[model samples]
Target: MSLTTDLAQAKSRANIRAKARAKSGSETTPAGEASPSPRSRRRKHRERIYQWLFLVPAVIYMALFFGYPVVKNIVMSFQDYTTATFFTGEAPWVGLANYAKVLSSSLFSTSLVNTALFTLGSIAGQFVIGLALAIFFQRKFPLNGILRSLLLLPWLLPLIVSSAVWRWILDKDSGALNRFLGGLHIVDTGIPWLTSTSLALIAVVGVNIWIGIPFNLTILYGGLQEIPDELYEAGSLDGATGWKAFRHITWPMLRPVVSVVLVLGVVYTLKVLDIILGLTNGGPANSTQTIATQSYDLSFHEFKFGEGAALGNVLVVISLVFAVLYLRASRRSVDE
Candidate 1:
């Protein structure tokens, strides 16, 4: 009886000692884990601070450059901002007047139509020819590398230089194209490739396609290279060859890259200004005048900065719409 009583007292004393230790330590700390030292906590906080510091430059750059410009452009579109406003530092708020004028203008419809036709023609021609060239270059042949490198020359040249060269090449009287045609006796007279309103846009589209082909080829070639060769090998074992292989194997693998190329091509083509400006200067009865050129004409030539800003915003909205559509389509594809 005395020994049992002594054991109970010892157990009670052990419980009291454990409770005392618990009261002195962190209540929220896990039973086995020691509380974090102040030095370790400070080190972790400093690491987090360093991580944020790395992002500071990028955030600042974006805010100052991209964010500010977009906001300024939007504000300018709503105000009567022009040369006088630049001098006086005062741009009168004109509400939707600038938008109304831009949207209601007859030139707007013409520019819109031209923009659509130019984008569609340029994208279609660039993608089709580029994909064909990409596929062709996938084969092994002598001088293949040299020829592929040479094909990139058009894309490497400056837009202004390309336009100038094409301008000379398409000249009615002495252009290389006309000269070649004349030598072959294909026509009695030189075709008015640039002077005629009907042919001017076509000529410009051709120039753009020539310039854009290399870009598409390079991207699509990379994509084709990324596709696994084993897939082709396995398909060949299953009797898939030539067009059948391309249809079942090559295309599905290339769709993601194709989507990127098409989206970028459309966006870039929509805002094309320098090429058209240099080629025809949006001339020949304004037949090739797209929204981009019209916006430039409004802002610089006419000094209607507000109207120009409004027109530019319209193009921006169109681009945003296309981007949004692409995102939604991509999401849907992923979901499926």
Candidate 2:
């Protein structure tokens, strides 16, 4: 009789549990709907609207500033427009005449070539030197903070100021560089650093490289610091040393940062103007002329505003192409 009573209690408990589970399952279901609660749905919609509201100001700003100017520049490139024509409203349509003139000009060709060379040389120099400095500074050394701060002086100074200082140092006569070289008997006479067509471009490129190095060093050093020390220790445990460790670990880890830096460096170097203007002014027989200076010369100096606009447009296209290529390459690297 006691056993029968225990079984009856156990059956009652199981029945109660089944009823409770059935009620819970019924509560979780919507009788005729296959969707979330109205409150949850409303919250998601609110979140999306909030996101768009946050983005609206930026979109409006771009349309007003960037989009408008780009369209205006394109229109100006097609018209026989000038500062005077703009105010007078008497410009005529030229339909690619300016582009034709720009393409045919020997000066434009030379400027493009010089721009390419300068960009490439400066980037290579800055990258190699910056990487070396970054690696060196990664080690714990005395006065590292002070040294790093001093190194940034080149990039921190105003561009015009840096260019002027370099100009004084590289001056053909009565320059510190010439005086030092002469004192050391490195050369019997002062070299004409800027007066010669051949040397002017080189001197300008050198100054640009000097200015860019500090920026590269700061970025790359920051990237290097973010890499974990444990990777190196792991490599050491595996009997990896020196180049092998760097090749297997550091290079892979740093690839993304390096790609970003290189792309940015290329774009910035290609658009350089202040250094060239302050240093050479595209003088010494126009040998140092770049697209930026050429555009200025055409529009402001010669009053060929349409042609100048065309040149500027070409620069924009080239820069855009390079940027797109970099982005695509970066994406591919990530995908692989």
Over all chains combined, what TM-score does candidate 2 have? Answer: 0.87
TM-score winner: 2
**Scored by CA lDDT, what does every candidate get?**
0.91, 0.86
Which parts of model 2 have CA positions greater than 4 angstroms off? 1-34, 330-336
**C-alpha RMSD by candidate, in order:** 15.1, 14.5
What candidate 1 gets wrong by more than 4 Å, as runs, is 1-47, 327-336
- The worst-scoring run of ten residues by lDDT in candidate 1 lies at 1-10
**Candidate 1 backbone collisions, by pair:** none
Give the C-alpha lDDT of model 2: 0.86
Question: What lDDT would candidate 1 get against the real structure?
Answer: 0.91
Candidate 2 lDDT over residue span 1-336, tens digit each: 443454455556656767875886788676644566899789868855765565566667778989999998898889998778967987789999999999899898899999898989899999989988998898898999999889999988999998898899998788889999999999898998988998888888888889988988999999899899999998899987788977898788888888888988988988898899899899889889999889878998899889999998998888888899789878788668
True-structure Cα RMSD, model 2: 14.5
Best by lDDT: 1
